[model samples]
Target chain A: MGEFDLITRYFQRPAKRSPLGVGDDCALLAPAPGMQLAVSCDMLVEGRHFLSTVDPARLGHKALAVNLSDLAACGAKPLAFTLALAMPGVDESWLEGFSRGLFALADEHGCELVGGDTTRGPLNICITVFGEVPAGAALLRSGAHAGDDIWVSGTLGDARLALEAFRGTLELPADVFAQARMRMEQPAPRVALGQALRGTASSAVDVSDGLVGDLGHILASSKVGATLDADAATGVIAAAASCGLGTEILRTCALSGGDDYELVFTAPPAARAAVEQAGKESATRVTRIGRIDAEAGLRIVDASGAPISQRFGSFDHFV
Target chain B: MGEFDLITRYFQRPAKRSPLGVGDDCALLAPAPGMQLAVSCDMLVEGRHFLSTVDPARLGHKALAVNLSDLAACGAKPLAFTLALAMPGVDESWLEGFSRGLFALADEHGCELVGGDTTRGPLNICITVFGEVPAGAALLRSGAHAGDDIWVSGTLGDARLALEAFRGTLELPADVFAQARMRMEQPAPRVALGQALRGTASSAVDVSDGLVGDLGHILASSKVGATLDADAATGVIAAAASCGLGTEILRTCALSGGDDYELVFTAPPAARAAVEQAGKESATRVTRIGRIDAEAGLRIVDASGAPISQRFGSFDHFV
Candidate 1:
């Protein structure tokens, strides 16, 4: 079949949420009245963002999920998206699996597949997501205050642990490995949690490149500092005890591991109750792990309140 | 430098036109109060959409220009765009040239670069563009009627001639080759022509594929057929005479060659004056090549009024 026919067969669907869909030159979208459009683009390349042997269905889900994480961080409701894909050649089975995974998540979020282009080349998937948020309501990394409580939703470091196991640097029980691999392959973006914490959270970011590194973005953008509680941070590492990991290894992964896709946010102490309520409403666990500070750099402190000088680096594509 | 730093240094600029730009998780766009947002995406891969030896600046321009052509076909005015780029390594000089070409056209069209991702991989460029048009004013391919006149903007076939020479299938004089090569390397998207024809043309499509193939899309969408004038079509080949091409060769290239980025539109006979006025307002030449018909399939007739049955196929990547 031709390239266009392939797209029509696998990717094109009736766009219920968008004004116009795949058949047209351009898809049309009308934002809710008095709302602003939130747009973000993310590209995934084979052997870099994903493994060559990765399942097509999971890869597709992760591709769109990564872009949706950006929108969730902005507290925007999912609306519509366009995918631009390049592949080495046509593989009908691969396309079928990929589209099924993609549409499943898209349907869950009510995000319509609006328009896109497909061509032959090395495998690459680029997705641009569009959503809407009331003016001035989007949670940004620059809104943190000096005294706000730092919080994180869900868990952290399991994806990184899974990667380590895959690379043969570590080993775990079969059940633990499977669970960790699932976290690595298919991240669930916390859209509802972001929308719930819109007014309550002072500043927010999604943890894509480890907890400390992603949180550093907020600190840099807001021109503030933070003091991460060592014990509290370790408590957020899911499955560490079950996996029989050492404390040092657990701390290293929790602090420096990337691809968690959890929300890290800050709110004033007075809004603590509201933040917790919001988390409960979204069915995501909220953990208070630190506090924003007036100082200029991030510091990790032990139970005795002594500063720890461990370095935690985030994922950098160019590095 | 890290990937984020590279983006900030090379791609980021003061986004005066957009509500929010690069630093945020999602760029914020607020379309004109009564206008609808039009979105289109196009992807370019190394050794596929372009030659590896091509100038980086031209490649950047073409990547965005192709997507803009889609917006133009929908009669949408440029607003903003997001770029997702992947590369094998960090090359400072390459990035400089690319961003320069990209921004030059963006500045001319007032389309702001808002938000995107940059990752390390094989070279790939994908751009998603956003535009705006008044409600119900877009020129759609399904709007053509059986009695409408078909018109094309700008000359055709030069780009195809360039490709043929590059592929060693044809030879031309240096000057003719240079002119044809320019057409293939840098196609000017018919943004103005499309915007001007919003209310005048019955249906419109940008000529990325061959004229016959792209025009067939309009026919299929509108459930109509067409009769192309062979002599009139040959006259639209801009540099064929200078290149010493035969009539048969001229006809083949003009009708079946792609990458024109021109506009092929149809309007009723009564709207002929309006269509001509649009072409004048847009400062683009318009040529009448055929007429839409009540018949079920396309037909081409020579000056002697004899039907030509030879086949002309358009470029299809998968085929």
Candidate 2:
């Protein structure tokens, strides 16, 4: 047994209990008439998720945003949240900026800041978000079906590329660099897209841990397989090429990087046009990348219809 | 600015925003429609909150119980929760016991297990609780009025006494020892008493950091003062005398030692009987030991009406 198993053992069986239980970003709760509650939590450690040098405001925003992304995954409308903050010492400006950024997003989402605690410790932030969804309708990763199409919202790998830029391993044109940094510093949680897909999406998950790995979640939960057309994903690179990003670098970044906070969802063949229409209505773009299959493995195929050998993995904390 | 202020500066002003906001155990949130939400969070460090040798099952129960105590303080009904756990390694039996204990209370309270994260680190357990109360009905620390009769549900000092025994600083009689340890290991959150007191009590708080200290929270929030009758509190010790506890030790433990998890609330003098009657209906005992006053200081008076002095402070993370 691993530590996760220990934690798992302590939890009630998710299957017989909650519609969505321990493993998801937040639980889908329908406690009363007409209203559904979405609850999610995320924790950011000092060294693991961010460097000490990162702006405190960005840290705070990221902490809340990560949790909000969970709500986005469930198509839950943001309602309110509590913050549990632990820090070794107080820094005024850092907190001001952090709270400013957090509240900016929260206010835009109509999320109320309710209750929380501030304690003395090494810096860490734990945020619990509560939101509401329509009763009897919530998106889940397990709803993907064979023959359904897979779609990803927004571009991927920009956040990862930004990290590489921060680490001095990657260089890009100034405009592309600014765009990559924006993807990292301020991620759009795909809330509108998720809400649009509430009735249409077969299965959905936010791509925080890279595209292939997160898409793997959909396949595993749906008990199906998938074949991805690399060119379709590389289309993001084609779009970035106008900003002077190398297609190869863009392809690698879009495929294997993490923390994009975009929604990757599956829809039935017939629902594709409707989904695209919904996205258009919301002024958001949707791109089709693959199709769910009856087989039991994931394979990425090139434009020539041959399997690509390049490996893909996402950010795993204890891997 | 201190680290707390620095971090908090980023957050928008919580004034008039939360019925109960930052710095409380759980946040009190008013969602749309019928129910208001009570939310609280607690984190237990490996060495600070408990010993590694302590039963993991008890630790899990206490972790959840402590947070529920916060909800209980606000007179809220339990709804659901999320747990964020960090541990170095997995121990199957320990995990089994822990989860069993956590679920036992959750089942009893009808609080569903919602969402959580499991990761590798030094042992820590952070649990956030969500509960509901009717709108505008949450018992707050700020509602006590001058001349209000202050009452406590259940006895106090048992948890602190148990800590003494656990540390080998004191030896207690067998039944007394068992009772105290049980108080420490499995605190009973006063959920029933809180719900029962909904309309009658003007102000309320749970005694986690000892009577004097926790009551001070009520005083500060309400901007009222209090005079505790030491003799009446001694009467509680006399009640415990049947269990073999001395009055002096009990008084000190009750006043300064923490972790009681009992609700200390204030009601108008005329409502005393109603409060007691409600307690009777719920089968949870209520004891009136003090009164809210117009002045702004805390005083503990002996049976003869003389002040008693003590050289102790409530629990502080940093001294």
lDDT of each: 0.89, 0.73
TM-score of chain A of each: 0.98, 0.86
Q: After superposition, how far is residue A143 of candidate 1 from its true place, in Å?
A: 0.6
lDDT of 1 by residue, B1-319 (tens): 8888899998899979787778878999998888999999999988878889889888878888898899899999999999999999999999999998899888889999999989999999999999999978888889989889999999899989988888899898888888888888788899999999988899999988898899989999899999988778778877676667887778888888888888999999999899999999999989999999999799988877689876788878788
Count of backbone collisions in candidate 2: 15
lDDT of 2 by residue, A108-130 (tens): 78776655555556666778887
* lDDT of candidate 1 over A1-319, digit per residue (tens): 8988998899888778777778888999999789999999999998888898889899889988998898889999999999998988999999998998898888889999999988899999999999899989999999999999999998888888888898998898988888888988999999999999989999998888889989999999999999998768778777565777887777778887888889999999999999999999999999999999999999998767788777778899999
Pairs in clash, predicted candidate 1: none
Per-model DockQ against the true two-chain complex: 0.87, 0.13
Tens digit per residue, CA lDDT, model 2, B90-190: 55577667877887887778766555665555566778887777767778888899999999888777788788888997778887888878888898888
Q: Which stretch of 10 consecutive residues in model 2 chain A shows the poorest summed lDDT?
A: A17-26
**lDDT score of residue A285 within candidate 2:** 75
Model 1: share of real contacts kept: 0.88
Q: How well is candidate 2 docked (DockQ)?
A: 0.13
Q: Candidate 1: where are CA atoms >4 Å away?
A: none
